[model samples]
Target: MTAAVRSTQQVFNLPDLGEGLTEAEIVAWRVAVGDVVEVDQPVVEVETAKAVVDVPCPYAGRVVALHGSPGELRPVGQPLITVAPLDDGADDAGRAGAGGADDPGGEPAGHAVYREEERAGSGNVLVGYGTGHGPAGRRRRRVGAARAGTGRRAAADDTAASTAALPEGHPTGTGAPVPTGAPAVVGDASAYRSRLDGELDAPLVISPLVRRLARERGIDLSAIRGSGPGGMIRRADLDARTGGPAGDGRGAGLAAVPDLRPAATAAATDAGADAGADEIVIPLRGVRKTIADKLSRSRREIPEVTIWVDVDATGLLATRAAINAAQPDRPVSLLALLARICVAGLRRYPQLNARVDGERGEIVQSGRIHLGIAAQTERGLLVPVLADVQRMDTGALSAALAETTAQARAGTLPPARLTGGTFTLNNYGVFGVDGSTPIINHPEAALLGIGRIVDKPWVVDGALAVRKVAEISLTFDHRVCDGGVAGGFLRFVADCVESPAVLIANV
Candidate 1:
């Protein structure tokens, strides 16, 4: 008679979400034990040092266990969930017994060992863990023939002996090797033979744990030349590829990773070496940490130079007034007008709308003007990208900016809305600041800062008169262009502010 096979549990570990982060606070869990999940379905929402990211489940199975609760910090490589692969309804004891003696575990010997190569996942891996590949092919299980005088202890003893015989450092538990001379356990031996032949035809990369480890270390697995049978990616091959163990010391040591800040700020971080009781230390994490890392990287990496020019904004203010007078109910913001001028300036000097690709050793100039507007929210400052600003008119641009700013302030802006910007327009003037240099948003080569347009004494047409004056500051990466390009872009914008007719002519 065929013996019923006990379901095997597969533990899914928390993957290092490609950000080089060690741990994340579990914000919420989307699944509970016993719930069946499909591949790529979001299993949890975790708050990393950079942002709140949704992590997806790689396995499609019945959830057997969940490891952490909400608000608990879980480290990379910790077991997150357990799953039991569903069985295919096939009963064939004769085929199972064909493999002969019981498995070293003392159970029906012919039960096929589940290979790790069969595991599947969705290819959509976020900063958090998801399967690096697509869905896996379906599999079947075989029931073994019952043996007399066999008990749980006997099976456990046999399993222990098999584990004891393995060489040191080899994977144990579910990864234990199949016994020698074991037949393929299945309903139809010929069908199983055909399937095995097909699988053997291709080189299989079978270790999810190894993949996760490689990802955490920023090691590209595909580039690694596998040494195992069928060119499989083994631990030894990965060791050679990475030149060390999987542990990059990200969880325990910060010194190993690249320093984000320059020496000055690094020294300043220790200014309060002896922190007083009155001092409140804020830990760098979440959005604040993300901002720090980005801004510091921008300051350290980009050779930025700022140039400012005070403009007679009498015409820009007059244009705004004329628009308001024409449409009293719908008021035009000064920032939107500034955005239009920026788009025009970028058209004349398209070199500023680019990023220095250090890896590729080239400058990628973007064709579209995806403008990022800086907004200060309750949580922190966030730049929500207003895509394709070159396509929008003053009315449309104004509406889009207002809506995006509202979303940013409400803390409901999606991650997608915060990225993919070609240029940034910062209206510090709204804060009533006269003139100040701003940090260039990383990746984007340039940022234009607009100061307050206030009534001031200005010499226009060689006459001293009270006119609306504003200051425009342009901060640009020197690698993309020199002072000639930056100065021209700023000067053109100043001209537009001084005379709106240039903008009208361009339009």
Candidate 2:
């Protein structure tokens, strides 16, 4: 044989997937220690700014270690995985231009990147290391774009570009990019401004989707400013600039432009959503990308089996109220009760709490249950796991739910909090939904959809009895379970919800 193709490890630090995204909530990891990964393979999923994203592994190798678990917030540039170089401990092999006088990774073997742009007359960069005591006023060319290999906090420091890295001489201000038609004097350029779209300039940092939206709406993206990181273009930026109901001032879907008016009735006859309405366009990055990838995978790869049921939740609600009163100060939600019920249900239908080893063509069933609570936030959807749900009581489940929601909203949830969920509980009831077919979170077998509880008249015993009723939908993996089993599992859930004491006895 000629020789082994030697390669070095590139600890691909997390890039700013979200526009000017400084941080992300780690949703899940696809690879584990000792698993071989191919380049471009989705290694991790994260949620950011209302969207989820999947980060593809840049290098192929065996995963040596993972930094954390799901729901954990990892800052940009943090090491997510450690890959063994193809060279196998040969430091000299495959090493490139990563050396710097002071590189934080201490690799001293990275590519050379111009950290600061040289302005026509400006002496140096705003931060340290750019200042040199030489020619009284020797200027540097601010023509080149800044090199960003790590997380750079892009603020609305210059112009309203959400993710703009300021020009050495550009007046400091945050609003929108130089109006769409503004001085096309410069090419599609970017640096680090965090108004909104600044951090999203992958390779070149241009918001292609946002520009496309603007063009389609008959509004020039350049004309509309940004209000996000580095002054990047945001949905609101476009909405405000276009006035409202964009284009013809009519309400429309994500594809329709915003109406120039604020009255809801103004665009009543339009397609849908304020597509071009009061909104700023943010290109999906980081967590948002992760979310998209996971959801896409779940919808695409697995054959989801959805089953719906309408249950009288009157008893469940009353039990919850009484339990809360008994444990005063510790509120218990219907979900807590549902969670306890689902955990117990899994005891009878173990397949729903299992994973498919596609590689081995075998199904791996888990005796213990890890419950994932589908959390909705301003950013997007996050399902932080309630590990060992089979073991927790209603009170413990209540505490976990409260803590998880609080941490999720605070943007302080840990990766561990978001991982290890074998079964997912999605409550669409909060939105008054009667029933819905939810997608299954893949690698796992099932996701339980909870619908709104309403006062519906039902004929019980003999006469008509008005009671609070809730709807539930169970979506499972057909490969791991059949309709008969899935239906039985859901019925078990309904029974527990109707009879609250079963949960206590099961525990």
Candidate 3:
């Protein structure tokens, strides 16, 4: 009778979500267990610190398991899903025997299955992970008949001997042999033992990130037993051994530090405990946590100064009205006009449109303007960038702004569009606010804030009259330039608002 071989399962880990984001919250799963999925099909929706993105599965197979549920955080390179190839139909005994003396190459049957699937895997690369192309006419070979008396250990020994026999630069089961001392990436639990039995003493680890975590924390992989399938070491294993939180990789290093702060007095402690009972604690995570970290870093690193000026926006509003009247189908917004004015100001004072490279002790001035429009969404505040704003006219800017704002509010903007801004333009006027000293988006030099354009008594042509006036505040990094340059930029913007002819003349 033919012995049955265990089906090889491929675990698809969460790929890096770009910009060095370490983890992502599983927003939703498109496929359930036992459901068939095709290569490049989106299996899950994940929200990174930057944006909500659909993660595509590289393997086309029946999903055996989903690693994380909605709202749970999964670290990059951690398993997101486990898929069993539809073509696999063998048991453990047959797999073991196939790797014995009967096979010339002595490679385990499971490794062959993995290689075949990978060769035909998804061509679409997700941020940082994907499989390579294989030959067009290569056909998959079936596992040979089981060699008698060859159990798991014998098969392991044969596989290890075969690996050792191969000379340097020769391909192993999966194209190239894993570099010595590096973690072995085994897809199947059955092959995990065989890989560990090889000449190398590396741990059975599939994720580079998990290995990096262990390396960073000075944790010995061989010492800690793996909690994952087939004794594969996972990040949780290291975290558990060190007594740190699953997400935090610092281990016990921080825990060992002594707390030198004076303890609260008995009465104060009692009062604080009573007050804490009524205090609600909301965890800062996802976009909120990201925003908090960035804002905190900006506050710590940037020496910022805020300067405000009340401008007569009557002409700006009138100009917007005239443009809309001319092109009724393409009505330009007040925010777009202000964006144009800001662009003009930036062109005049290029120093304000730059970032400080503190480490390099230099200011990097950008030749192009990538304008970030601050839009408050249900998720949080998002700044979708409009690349090369210097090349776009008022009409194009208006249309692009509307589309980007819509995408932001609907939470549909991609991760790439949410970054790379040289400057930011915030319209707090929508919230009926007069003015706000907005925080400068970190790395960028300045943020321009616009207040509501409302009817107010203003001195126009040396006479008091009710006019459409607004407050504009410029919060800039003091490191980039002095008040003279900042004041000049703000004055230019105000001039454009008071008389559109100034902007037209510059244009």
Candidate 4:
């Protein structure tokens, strides 16, 4: 018996790609099955809630199958690649995460066999299996009223531990303040809320956010829930319940309310009756779909810890103004300026530019910096990268950024325009935010959030003076970096922003 040329198949699934360590959105495919692939080669591009990233191959073999079709939903641990072993033997189709062993779909392919130790550009080293356990822990849910004075709900993470350090310049969760004064019985809507109570096991299930929208519009989900599988609530479920097909439920309040003139028709008030037609109801496809996928993953995996720091951004603001005044013909926003600062800062503190290779069980430090810039669009958040940012001068980076964003906004951004970002920068500043503890893009150590820059009271030269300042927040993976390194990286970034001249690193 010629020992049946034992050839094994290696599989790679979508690895969680963010500090939130969440799911990924399949953005594009670089290769097809039946094609030969090398280990550490770019296989696909995925978008986290923050940036678009290229996931490289961990196996070197002939591509046998692909788990996710373009625009399809691929959960983490679901095989993404099937590679044939090198030998001619027919029995080698198994063996994935046991580091070079052959077992049929028994483990994740975090790193392909052969070159198992830490290697640059390897896809995220996932665990042998998916850890789909229930939510970890929760102190009683924070009520809406109790969440007063919250800095930003979208920015505050529920997982931030109390140990992370904060010195003022960074963004931290200032959870909505405790409700004060009277604890009055406020009654206005949904009886179902009290009916179901805590453990929601309704056959007709809908997220709280979705249910709130339905209640506000006077639309009932009970009828719609009946149409779905096991009474699951879908967007289309509610849509078809009404007379209009594909119509929005926003202004249906008036239609649903009964008329007092005819006692038979008297019902609830229509809060959004006849709202403008410009109002858009997004179907939550593509970019928005990407957001949902990533956010879900972040919440599922990883223990998150957040810290805040407040810095004197005057020097950085002055430098930005001076640079813009000097280079009037370029595309230089605070983001473009911040990217340069980050590139320089990473040179001083490489920890922020690194990622955790879990499957292969290694820590990686990247020498090059690829920056992802989060762009707000009609669809949702899309992160297009400014590749090799370290090599580009400030002016070159600014122009490239200008062109890339114009293309992104126009929906003309080519598929290539969205790939290969190693790190990300989300500028919430444009939205009037002072600071936020953003989730780091997966495989990348950290993500920097740029808050709105405004004049604020600052202690300058032993006196409180008005100074232009902005909040710079960094959310890093706790598994890969310690507070000392993360805080040091933040300090370096704050240094650059406080005085842009500091970015002139003697590279």
User: What TM-score do all the candidates reach, one by one?
Assistant: 0.52, 0.51, 0.63, 0.46
- lDDT of candidates 1 onward, in order: 0.65, 0.58, 0.69, 0.54
- For candidate 2, the per-residue lDDT at 278 reads 55
Q: Ranking by TM-score, best first?
A: 3, 1, 2, 4
- Compared with the true structure, what per-residue lDDT tens digits does model 1 show for residues 1-507? 233432345677887665467887775565544344566665666666644555666676555567887657899889887765544222223323543443221223444423233348755655223334222111112112222332111223333433433334444424566443211112222222232322323222344334445654566765776675335566556555644323433464543554434322432332223222244355566677788888999999899999999999889888999999999888888889999999999999999999999999999999999999988653466798999999999988999999889766644455667788999999887676899888889999999998888899988779999998888899999999999999999999999999999999988
* Cα-based lDDT at residue 30, candidate 3: 54
Could you report the Cα RMSD, in angstroms, for every candidate shown? 19.6, 15.5, 17.5, 22.2
lDDT of 1 at 346: 93
Index of the highest-TM-score prediction: 3
Q: Candidate 2 residues 1-507, lDDT tens each?
A: 014422334466776443355887665554444334555555665665544445665565545557766657789888887665433433322222233324332223443321222112232211111233111111100111222354221222222332134433333223224332111111121221121223333322133334444555566654444665444564456556656433434445644532333222223222124353554444455545667777898888788878888887887888988877897888887778788788778887898999888899999999888888887654456777778777777788888888877556544454556667798989887765688888787778899988888899987788999988888889999999889999998888887777766656766
Candidate 4's C-alpha runs over 4 A off are 1-284, 505-507
lDDT of 3 by residue, 1-507 (tens): 142312367788988676788999876565545345667666776778877656778787656678876668999999999876656544322433565544432334433322234336755645213323221101111111122232223333434433443333334533454332211222232334334334244455654345556655677887877775445576558667765443344566766553222211222232334334454344578777888888899999999999999999998889989999999998998889989999999999999899999899999999999999998875678888999999999999999999899767655576778789999999988777899988889989999999888999998779999999899999999988999999999999999999999999997
lDDT of 2 at 7: 36
The predicted structure with the larger TM-score, 2 or 3, is 3
In candidate 1 the C-alpha lDDT for residue 357 amounts to: 94
Cα displacement (angstroms), candidate 1, residue 237, comes to: 62
Model 4 is weakest, by summed lDDT over 10 consecutive residues, at 180-189
Q: Runs in model 1 with CA error above 4 Å?
A: 1-278, 328-330
Deviation of model 1 at 182, angstroms:
55
Q: Is candidate 2 or 4 superior in lDDT?
A: 2
lDDT by residue for model 4 over 187-232, one digit each (tens)? Answer: 1112222221221333343233334446655577654544433344
